[model samples]
Target: MLIELRPGTSAEAAEEVAARAGAHEDVTAWPVRLAGRVFVVVSGDESLAHVPASPAVLARRPTPDGHWLVRRDSGVAPREVTIGPPLSGPPEAPRQVGVVGGPRLWWAAGPCALESTEDAVETALTVRAQGAHALRAGLSKTRSSPYHFPGRGLRGLEALAEIRRAAAIPVITEVCDPREVAAVAEVADCLQVDGRQLDNRPLLAELGAQRRPVLLMRGPRASLDDWLRAAEFVFTRGNSAVVLCAGATGTPQQPGFGAITALRARTELPVIFDPSHSTRSASLVAPAALAASAYGADGLLIESCTKPERLYRPGDAAHMFPPESLADLVATCERVRDSARSLEVSC
Candidate 1:
């Protein structure tokens, strides 16, 4: 059974209830600190009847599957727009692409930017061989510095199309301008809206009209409410295939997992974590990736390259994961996800 403590309930009050529940011989109380709730697994038939209840307990519900289904009122007013069906892939592979509604993890891997046709193709092949489900690259890169490489425009999209055809995998690419949406939608399997462009309504409207799945990156400085409102712009435009990509914010020492947790709790959209940008460190990617999976991310969008040292892009040294390292990270992430699933079931 899952129980939600009332809002503003003191920690001491919650702990008192937890202790009382834990004292029951057949009940094992597990406090979910993230959401400030408690899950009491009832093992004995008589204990269920003995459990205490009070006004402080907002909700108590049984979950036969051992998974808690939590729904809280976010207090954000609903937009005056139609919400389409839950976004999903084809009928056969229903949850492959859209926000995954299952335990299976989706993997997206490729170079941060499309270096060239040859480089993109080679990297795509390597990613596919190493168990990635999709390919991601920037067709028109967004950089903070004016001198940085600004991706291969139309040529990159052409290369991604060719790689998609050859590799038999879905291709995902970033689109920074409204003018480029139509062209990017033509070749890319999913269009990614960069974090910097979250408030660009014209571009969001253009993407919504394309009817293709979109990966909306959460702005580093934007609040959770702000991010979801941006998604609302896309959702209200008749396109429901929206995935939330949680980008890191704050200093390197304090990456934003709070926003990730809040987004997962507040919205039904599939959430994907970009550990490459989250930690901004190749060395920290593995640990962060594992943490994301354990924290219930539906998928991961990673930046990797065939040759990190040979790359000329800024942050290449800090963020690029080599093929071997990526492979290891993927394997470990899979294990962590499997373990998490097991724990969920055993609860």
Candidate 2:
């Protein structure tokens, strides 16, 4: 069950409640202030039979969705993560290219990893020209097998910073370890917690305390219920700037995106789609991306290599797209979105 304390509730009051609930050996309690509300999520003792009575309590509700805080019923306003400077801002003024999200569709595109400084910067420039809002690169890849590329590790962060400067574009990357959080934040406009790190509470907490918005990808096996609960871990620390990435259903070929509906229905966070990663086939990426856009995804994340032949991956030709194709995909998505709005207006 979840308990929400009224506004202006003292920190001590929440602490006292946690202390009281924690006294119960079978139960654990932690207080979080997220989205301007103070909530205490107590696991184990769902009935709150032994909880101390207090005036701070504003509401008490059962958590059927794993974590009550993320449910739409919590009344948290929907959050749209704004990245980069506003698009209309002067391009020559500090940065050359910038992106924004909320009422507008934004795209983030780049290769899966920073193979080198030159390649990374080159890819960023290509995507920026193609209207990419942010550059997505992997500094440290938490892939399933250690045998595969481990990315450039911390060295790639230096390249990422350079990419931000040379390309004049915002950088989005992942931090696999909690220790890497501080360093990663120095270069990343947005931090990502991949499926492998979905349950890493410490990393989530570390990211939650930072200023950058977090892009959390749903694990292959995670249900909407599980995904929402995982998001709470980040929200618990203070920052609620979280964007959920609905991923595939384990199988790379299947590209299951049906959960977008459930995610939209449950959480207020802006939900995006990663059809490129979901399908793992370049031929299917555009179609899947277009399909997701029609479903009203707040943003699209895709893998694109300017020179696909040189990119090292298991399925280069099958999975990686060139910059031109993604630009076309974005343009097509915008046209479709505009048409849909017009239809609604006409009706």
The candidate that wins on TM-score is: 2
Question: Model 1 residue 128 lDDT?
Answer: 76
Residue 299 CA displacement from its true place in model 1, Å: 0.7
Worst 10 residues of 2 by lDDT: 85-94
Give me the runs in candidate 1 sitting further than 4 Å from their true place: 1-99, 251-253, 341-347
Tens-digit per-residue lDDT, 1-347, candidate 1: 54556777776776666666667666655333322233332333434433467656776665443223312242222211111123223332212242243456777888788786777778878887787777888888778888998888876766777777676667789999899898887677788888888889899878867767788887788667667767756643446567778868754434565665676556666777888888888888778889888777778899887766666686775787776567678778878878876787431
Instruction: Tell me how many clashing residue pairs each candidate has.
Output: 0, 1
The whole-model C-alpha lDDT of candidate 1 against the native structure comes to 0.67
| RMSD, every candidate, angstroms | 15.1, 3.9
lDDT for 36 in candidate 1 is: 29
Candidate 1 weakest ten by summed lDDT: 76-85
- The TM-score of predicted model 2 comes to 0.86
